[model samples]
Every structure is written in C-alpha cells, then in structure tokens.
Target: MIIAFWVSLFIILYTFIGYGFVLFLLIKIKRLFYTPASFDANLEFPSVTILVAAYNEEDIVDAKVENTLRLDYPQEKKQIIFVTDGSTDSTTEKLNRFNDVLVLHEDSRAGKMAAIKRAMPFVEGEILIFTDANTFLNDEAIKELVKHYRNHKVGAVAGEKRIFVDQTADASSAGEGFYWKYESLLKKWDYELYSNVGAAGELFSIRTRLYENVESDTIIDDHMIAMRIAEKRYIIAYEPKAYAMETASANTAEELKRKIRIAAGGIQSIFRLKKLQIPLIIRYLHFNTSVIVC
Candidate 1:
C-alpha cells in the first residue's frame, strides 16, 4: 500500500514539474536558433484562397470580410470565399456585398467541415487559408503564412490566435485566456523544434495541393487540416506575428461547449490519424502539458 501511495504521489509530482521542465528546455532550444519570416525574391509568390465558414455570424460578418480583403497580397493573387451552410441570418447577405468574395450558401444545416468541402473545388489559389468568421486576421497574415512555404518542406502554417478578454467576464474567460497563452507557447516551440501538432481554428493556412478533404463530420476542421498535412511528412509551422483575433466564447457555457467539442475531436483524431502518431513526438509532449495545465 505504501509503495503504491508513494508511486502515485511521485507520478503527480513528475507530471507537474516534468511537463514544465520539458517546455522550458524546448523554449531554451528555440531561443538558441533564429528564423526569418520572409521569402527570397527569386521564389515566386503563390496565390491564396481565404475560406471562411459562417453560421449565424451576422453580427461580425462584415468585419470579417473587411479584415480578409485587407490582407497584404496582390489583389489578383488572392481569392476570397465565404461559405454559410446553416445560417438563417444576414450572414449571406452581408458577405454578398463584396464582389470579390465568392459566397456559397445552402439552406440545409450541414456542419462546418461540410461547408469547407463545398468550397474546396472552387478554390483557385495555390494556398488555402481556413479562418473563422468570428475571428479577424492581421493585414499581413497571408504574407506571413505564405513565407513559410518558401521552404518546400512546410505544408501548413498555423497562426497565433488571440482572445480579447472583457474585464467583466467571468472565471471561464480567464481560464480560456490562460489556456491559449500556454497553447501559443507550445505551438511556437513545436514549430521551432519540429512542426506544430495542430492549428488554431481561428486561422491556419495550407498548400492547396497538400490540402485533403477531411471527413464531412469532422468536429475540428482546423486541427484535422494540420494533422492531415503532418501525416504527409510535411511540417505545420507557427507564425506568431501572423495573427487572428476573436472574442472569448459568448459565455462560460458556450465556451465549455466549444471545449468539449475540441476534446472529443482530439480523441477522435487519435484514431483517424493513428498512422501519424509514431512520428509526432512534439504532439505527444505538448499534449502532456495541456491535459495537466487545463
């Protein structure tokens, strides 16, 4: 009994301290190297397609389109697509105001991944960016994401997601804020040490050729997108400066729903991507920290 008790205590201690130590070592190693987020002049810049899936996002659809259209790239080199599958609101109407945006809408309430699948064939850009309608990207997001492709080995890039907290919000907001900060750190180091395990749902970009159609019922399309690319022996990098910003979930319950779905997706991804697990040491290590920290 004593041996078992001591073992359990040791395991708990090791989990708490050991995870921090591993993250610290990784951060140290990352600071040990330097990387530049720019491409050589000789490398031809590729076209990009920004794809957004919206559901009842009328409140922010206009802002989303404005932010997307303002991305730094040649207008001719960018294709904007907004897909609204389940929205009964003005989301489709607001998106239609922009002639450059190709809006795809269906009255049927298919899931988010289904919406993205419908937009796939319409994407003409060499690169495809999947973003949430509620989140807005920085002006240089496209440029930063594309620069990673300068290295042929990089198949996907996940941008940092920032949650703007309202001080009046409750403890869940604080928790969510803290969680993403830790996540941002993990992704930064993962990309530095090897490749990011998963992309933030707010904004992630991938090579069009490398883009694969995820399962129609995918719970977390952004993560599945990155993991799928990682399975192809390609790296999913993190560009912190290229960012997407969104508000915390409407409240704690809504946020919990979001969290539960993500947790479920994480479990599902293990089976969907069993073949890739042996190669993703960073994901294994990073996940250890997350389950503990959360």
Candidate 2:
C-alpha cells in the first residue's frame, strides 16, 4: 500500500507540475542547437476559407460575421462559409444577408462534425480555417496562420484560445482561464519538441489538400482533425500570436458539463485513433500522464 501510494503521488506531481519544468529545461537546451525555421513573407498568400459552425447562435452570429469580415486578409484571397445546421434562431436569416458569405444549413440538427462535412463541398480555398461562431478572432489571425503554410512540412496550425475573466468571474471562469494559460504553454513546448496532440476548436486551420472527412459521430472535431494530419507525419504548428477570444462558462456547472463531454469524446477519440498513435513508448507515457493530470 505504501508503494502504491508513493507511486500515485509521484505520477500526479510529475504529470501536473514536473513535466512543465522538464519541458522548459529541454526547450532551453534545444534552442542552443536549433534555430527555428521561418517563412518568407514575400510569398503569395494562398486562398483560404473561414468556416464557422453554429447551432442556435443568433445572438452572436452577427458579431462573428462582422469580426470575420474585418479580418486583415485580402478580400479576394479569402472566402467565408457559415454552417448553421439545426439552428432554430435567426442565425440562418442573418447569415444570408452577408452577400459575400456562403451559408449552409438543414432544418434537422446534425452534430457539428456533420455540419462541417456538409459544408465541405462548397470550400474552394487552398486552406480551411475552422472557428466557432461564438468566438471572435484577432484581425491578423488568418494572416499569421497562412504564413506557416510556406513551410511544406506544416500541415495544420493551431491558434491560441483566450478566455476573458475578471474579478467578478465565478470559479469556472477563473479555473478555465488559468487552465488555458498552462495549456498554451504546453502547446508552445509541444511545437518545439514534437507536434501538438490536437488542436483547439476555437481556432485551427488546415491545408485543404490534407483535409479528410471527420467521422460524423466525432465528439471532438478539432482534435481529430489535427491528429489526422499528424498521422500523415506533418507537424501541427502552434501560433500564439493568432488567437480567438471567448467568454468563460456561466458557472462551474456549465464548465463541468463541457469538461465531461470533452473527456468522453477524448476517450472515444483515443480508441478510434489508436491505429495512428505515436509509436514511441516514451511519448505514450508522457501523453497519458499529462492527460490524466489534466
């Protein structure tokens, strides 16, 4: 029992705290020998499609549309598509008013993954960027993501997710905000050492050519999409400069529900993606350790 207790304690501490320290030390050593690669800004930007998925998001769809239209990318080089599958609100009607934006919807509610799949045929851009309708992105987010594509080895780019919290925020808001800060750090380290395990749904982009149809039953679409690209031996680059801003859950209950769903989906994804799992036993240890602690 003593041995088991010690073992469990070590696992928890190492996964939650020690790993970050170890990762930081390793990154410093790596920087001594490795100069990060850069892409030339002079190269022409590829066409990109900004795909936003919404379900009963009438309240925020207009703001999201405005935020998207305000992006810094050249108008001619980018296309916007909104998928509102099963949105019972004024989301579809509001989206239709955008002359340049394409809207895809069906009366019956299918899952977000299903909505993305249904909208795929209409995507003509060389790159596909996925974002949630409730989130707002920086004006240069797309531009920052596009620059990474200059490197042929980069198959996808994961943008940072920032949660807004303040003094009046509840426990969920504070906790989630703190968690994302740590997660962002981990993603940076992952980018330097290996590839990000998955991408956050708030904002992530992939090469259109590398895009594969995600399972309609998928619970975590962003992670699955990023992992699929990683399976092909392409790196999922992380760009902290490009980020999406979103509000925290109303309270702990809402946050708990969200976490539970994600946890279930994550477990489901692990099994589905087992065939494409990273082969190194050491990598597996690190992956599961971090997951459990999180």
Model 1 bad stretches (over 4 Å): 1-17, 26-44, 285-293
Give the clashing pairs for model 1.
Answer: none
Model 1 over residues 119-141: C-alpha lDDT tens digits?
Answer: 88899999998888888888988
Total backbone clashes of candidate 1, pairs 3 or more residues apart or in separate chains? 0
Q: How close is candidate 1 to the true structure, as a TM-score?
A: 0.88
Question: Using Cα atoms with residue i matched to residue i, what is each candidate's TM-score against the true structure?
Answer: 0.88, 0.94
* Sliding window of 10 residues with minimal summed lDDT for model 1: 285-294
What TM-score would candidate 2 get against the native? 0.94
lDDT of 1: 0.81
